[model samples]
Target: MLRDHLQRYDPVFQHAAIGMALISLQGSFIQVNPVLCELLGYSQQQPDSISQLDHAYQDVLSAVTEFGGSLQSQPLPQGTFELQIQQTAGRQLTVTIHLTLIYDEQVPQYYLAQFENRSLLTETKTQLLSTETMLRDIQDSYQQLLEKMPLAVLITRNGVIQYVNPAALQLVHARDQSEAIGISTDEIVDSSYHYSLSERRKTYYEHQTPLQSITYLINCMDGQQKLVEGFTLLINYDGGPAAVGVFKDITEQREKEEFMMQSEKLTMAGQLAAGIAHEIRNPLTSINGFMKLMRSSDRSSEAYFDIMESELKRIELIVNELLVLSKPQSKHKSQAVDILPVIDQVVTLMDVQATLKNIEILCDKPDSPVQIVGEVNQLKQVFINLLKNGMDAMASSGSIHVMITTNEHEVLISVKDEGSGMTAEQIQQLGQPFYTTKETGTGLGYMITQNIIHNHGGSIQIDSVPDRGTTFTVKLPKLVSVEASSN
Candidate 1:
């Protein structure tokens, strides 16, 4: 009776778009529509039924068999699944397969299977995945550009920072962007510039200036102070007025300008001193010759002539030191000069003075000569001046220790004095022209010494403690030798 009823609808099922098939419990095809044959690339001699031996529909048959087994123990409603079917032309199609069991008085009779194509759904899903990938790439590119920007970028509302890029976090010495977010912008700004910056921010919000530029001092989390040139834009953020600032550090630039100005002033002062020294030295030389003749002519005035001669010699000494200070530094004759021999020569020259003051001179040097490319005479002058100062600092007796050490890139020469040390205030005043600690000392010595070291691309550091002693460490780059490459 069921077969007769199904046969009555054969005309409707034969021409339907969905593929349909009828199969018996023994897995043999009872009947198949033209649509089913076309979908499987079958001829009029289509396969009898679902078969596990066929590769194209093996996956579908396995699922159908499992469904059919479940129908044996209990009645089941229609069920659906999806599978990819390959035709003889090597083309593939995704189809949804629906299965229903036809029972004859509680005994399994046949399975009615239907397949609906799902090719359009697969195409839409593929397009969606490609679009998502493109969007993610665009977002990553935007994030990379922001991180690589040279200037620091900050976005704020009501003085509270809302966003800070990596550059901004680095500018403020923040560990990361999270540390800078939600913090008050005023906290990082230097106190002196707080009111001014705040006022500018207010002006932008009140009138919507759109753009403004200013320079201010900013204090970093690491305790460093910087002068930053900021360009700010007034923008709408989250439906309210906001300020976006881009800052470039200008501290080093400003310092360079000031140094150039100071250099000009020093040049002028040197020219004036040179002229005055020349004018005084000529007259003083003639007076000294006349005093010498008078001392030789009569013993009665000899003692008085001696006193005058000593004062004249002191004046000459001051004039010579002044000339040295006014002289311009030259690097043309620099060579790989051994620092050990130079230090030894300076020690020999000052050894007599040290002995007279009951002081000992000790030297520690490596066996190999420590070499640097610099003016040999200037290096000698530096060691001599520093050693003399150490001798002068010790009133009665003490030892002067000079040590030389070397590393891969540089050489370190340290001069230590066991004498009355200097206070912090006194140390700060060092290297200034016309500033000295000793009554008879001329402050130009240290200033000239530092100038020579700086010209050689070296640096000097002094460590002193009150009532103890002082140590001056000089660091100079070592001369590196290049080995010839083998041909």
Candidate 2:
């Protein structure tokens, strides 16, 4: 029966796909399959000449002897291990070997071994581990950069906040990231802008588009409102799409702008008051003379009273114009203002200044009322800036022509000064902040004027020649009708 069993096992072991071998307890090969010979690059006749198995034999022997003297009393033990082996040509190959002990009549006989080449599998796993480590390093570096950025940054997905950087937390006065994360974007943005923000987010997600720089009023945790200018774009995060917003706090910038505007307004008022001082005094002198004549005479004449009243009204108009220009303005109030009256008032206020400089201001009023929807005070300031710029450009006595013309869609008011004209380069730099041709000019006036015109949905253009003069043409959208303006 043992002979028959050996005959059955020999064919199966010899024809096995994997390398197979049978070794004696003394570590000498009892049988070696053709597959084992090929795997070690050895001839079938040299089964005992496997020098590469020398080191592996020691380990196998040690493992088998661990069961020691009780091997026969206990169940037969099997062991497996991995090692690098040398082929016939000295090439190194990694392999896994499985060892099992065979028992004959309940006595240890030989060891059965199976070998599997793991060189390619080992190389592949090593490459995968290296790639994973590199990716982890890159992610760590990116996270560090985001943490240190000064600009406020946040990430959101499906309109829910996912991340907030330190700057973002400070901007909204949040205690920590936990206070902001998981909150809806609508909760952070002002309620007035919720609809617009929702629509913008919807459009971006639907089309995978990026949002342009826009100003937002953020409702802070501390019940403070902050203005931030930011842009949003879609980014891949954790294998999914998310929106990353980069923002700059513009609240201080806007406040500074308002403060500058107010400063310019005061400066202009001071200049206007100085220029009209004599005009105010002339009327006051006339009224004083009339009062003296009435006090000395027995009775006051109706014509004298009329003259006094007219002089007083003149002083009052001048004072009122000065007050309007110098007063603190309500930044948000706007109405349909007739352009003609605004120009007339500006001309009247500036006329005395022009007269002092020996410059005549000629205003050509339109027959029909040309009206525009804007803040009246801002419009007054716009004209004041233009007229002052015109006056400053002149060296000597010259006329400043103010012309009002209209097209089907817009109204054009041109202030042409017979002063030192500018070059094309100077004209190009007209609206830039802190760029001025005058020795005493702040250069904020034109910039503020340009901002106000743009806010009113209008534009200003300049035409100049070196020796001739400069013309500032302001184009404003014409109000369609009284009813339309009211609506």
Candidate 3:
């Protein structure tokens, strides 16, 4: 009897802060703990003398009864619940309930049971929810600030990317958030080193040892690579362990370092070879000029002049290659445009080839206009690149499907090919510059394509399988002006 007393109603019943009660299926209370009496301002009562679960948890009772068996709340699931119960004086009070379904071990039966204070629980939960909402708002504002930032800001746990800022979109050459989120560093990064880095992070986390400092090569999706030096800290999030790393794109730093090294070499080369290059330029121009003069002098000697002229042009091309080390710059603003016209142009360009191969193209667009903010010429380039790649990937009898969709603030275009697709490894490196699978590829085509899309502030995504085909989806944000907003 003494053992039973302690087991049922001793420490937990008298001392625990939460309300405790046993209520029957018929809607009568079987037991009320001291905490329950204090919560509802009722006197402590005997077992089998209590209030009903229906009064306190009407929604839970209804939902459980309607659904049958036990149920849990959504968005955030918890063993505890929020409820309202009445005091003996007939005032209703709100409470937070830690609930359980008591099952008879011998027979098949479930009894509704719960623990919490009625009045205090409601007030506390209400305040906490308000605070949580405020915090979420601040966090949202912070994310927006980060998104507007030019630097690539990312949040990660271990080596997995949790959140990435807008700058990361351009850095990875990604289409958008869909392509960027949940992407592990190893997947988008060029180096195999990130795999080992991930393994090390895992090991440290498993042993609860925080990562101190690390430096290594990291792959970028843009074919622009980097060597990153970073420090990590361990912290708790949502009652669980997490590692947060704040990092900057080290590519520019590496570029500056390489430029300094190259500047020294170039200075020495200029001193040694400056006279030679200058001397050759004068002779080469004179020789070409004399060749052109000779070609016009006699028709029979035209073939010889042609040979000489070809050599001169070849020399010019070589010189141009040397000068191309300094990249060109372009300045263009995003403008409103319809993408259908761009697709039509690509089809026209590739029409002859498609006809020769007996391939068919299918285009689907809405009857209404689909508009977005982007560079029409640049988006045209993106279309041509994607369409040409698709054409190359497919057989003579293949078919290409183009779909255009529009929402209030964006436009989407998807071009799909029914042809040989890419492997997992190839897919991982598809958008990377200089990472082509083709034999005679310069590997810079996709690199240029990705840059064009970034300039337009649009995203491009490639989805493909091993044998099915490839689909390129581009999303461009629509211009949302005050006039549009008012409408």
Candidate 4:
């Protein structure tokens, strides 16, 4: 009655869902339950008649026996694996058989074994493999994204590469992943850029002065050279001294800058020539007058003198033009001129021409002056050029908005147009000598405007969105007390 009650109350021990077996100290199954018979496809043969020493691998089972016997008292070791057995089935199976040894009264002779079907384990393995495949697919997608990016992405801390994206690897031409990581930038950068990087490192690390908006150099992995301009900042990476830097490969930009630099060299010569021409003009004028007087005195000598005098006068006039290339362009000469008045004046000058195309010129101006420095007339010239550019950019009819603001350090004068703006590549090429977007454009307008502003101590920048619009911003320092005194 007690045995029936035990079987009824604790069915798990007597009639478990899984196979059960009893293993002896000699690496053999002494007995197995009905479930074990079912798991191994065995018939209801007596378990006492079956001994399977070969079913459990002799070596591993021996080790398992050793480890199992040495355990403290009650609980079995978890995460244990062993290869073991079924004699009646006549087939060997790789299984994870869990066993608990019970040692109480009779020489510590009993062991309880649970047999989980290898097929079920196999199915579980297959499900895990599918999940692993999905994880691998996700990793592959992330790798592709890193490879295709246009920007060079690097994660570092105080200039150590914690991470570098594939684009950076391709650009720098690192052979493999091992070559790229934890290597100092000095390894790849040229000797010239090495010093610059050191200075930047000092500024950032020792000084603790952040370089969030710094432009620095990077030598690419390829044999081809580049000046990589980047912005760097300190960030946390799994909580460490993480720095992130994103940069563009600026080899082409540097080439274009070289062209601009050449143009600047030529312009500086023009300034010197203009200064020299001013002194030479007075003497040349007197010399030409005396030659004219000599020509009138003798008829035979007149043509010869006339030719000499004419050539001299021509040279003198050319010198005068050079002198007027700029005038009193002193950075000091400035006035409180409202931008609205200036825009109005420019529109008046080009109103008839703008009307020809049926274009509308719009002005969003504040009542007060967006007052900066320099001459009103000079600023009017800048306004006229920009307005005329806007008008010319449109095909049939379009709008040009002159946006004036007291926005920043300098009064901002913006000329925006609905006409097709330049591409990023084209914008980078703007302000270059003889580099214009227009069919008949000389490309000297912005160059001249830039010079005019420089003479008045200011600068200009352009922003554009292709097929949308272009915005030209003129920033000149506001005329102040020092400027008044200098003038």
Q: What is the lDDT of candidate 1?
A: 0.81
lDDT (C-alpha, whole model) for all candidates: 0.81, 0.81, 0.65, 0.68
Clashing pairs in 4: 19-36, 156-243, 171-221, 172-220, 172-221, 173-221, 334-374
List ranges where model 2 is wrong by over 4 Å. 1-17, 30-77, 84-94, 103-108, 119-131, 236-239, 265-487
- What local lDDT score does residue 28 receive in model 4, on the 0 to 100 scale? 67
Instruction: Rank candidates, TM-score, best first.
Output: 2, 1, 4, 3
Q: Model 2 over residues 1-487: C-alpha lDDT tens digits? A: 5456467679878779998877667665656678877887777776455554554456644544443323445565576678777776787788887877777787777777788889889888999999999999998997888899999999999889999989999999999999999999899999988887988887886877778877899999999999999998789887889989999999999999999999997886676566577567877999999999999999879999999998888777656655544344446577888999989999999999999999999999788889888988789889998999999999999899999999878999999998889998888877544457987554557766777788788999899998799999999998899586588
Residue 14 deviation, candidate 3, in Å?
Answer: 54
- The sequence of per-residue lDDT tens digits that candidate 3 reaches over residues 1-487 is 3245336655666676676655444434555577666665655654333434346545545543332233323332225556565565787776566545443443323334555455656668899999999999987897788779776666666567777777767766676877777777777655667666777677776787867766556656666666666666676544666665545567678889999989976874674366336534764886777677776875546666676676567556445433432233146666677667877887788778877788888888887556666667666767777777888887658888889887877788898998788887887776533356654343445666766766666778888886799898988786666677998
Number of the candidate with higher TM-score, 1 or 2: 2
Q: Is candidate 1 or candidate 4 better by lDDT?
A: 1
Q: What TM-scores do the predictions have?
A: 0.49, 0.53, 0.36, 0.38
Q: For model 2, what is the error of residue 236's alpha carbon versus the real structure, in angstroms, after optimal superposition?
A: 4.2
* lDDT ranking from best candidate downward: 2, 1, 4, 3
Task: Compute the lDDT of residue 260 as modeled in candidate 4.
Answer: 98
**1-487 in candidate 1: lDDT tens per residue?**
7668577659867678888877656555556677887777776454543342244565566677677667666646467778887776787888888888877777677888887878778878889999989977976896687679888999898889988888898888899878888988788888998889778867776776766688989989999999999888777665787888899999999999899999988885885477446545654776677677776875446665676676577677667877897688764488889999999999999999899999999999999877799988899999999999999999988899999999888899999998899989999988755568987766778988998999898999999997789999999999876541232
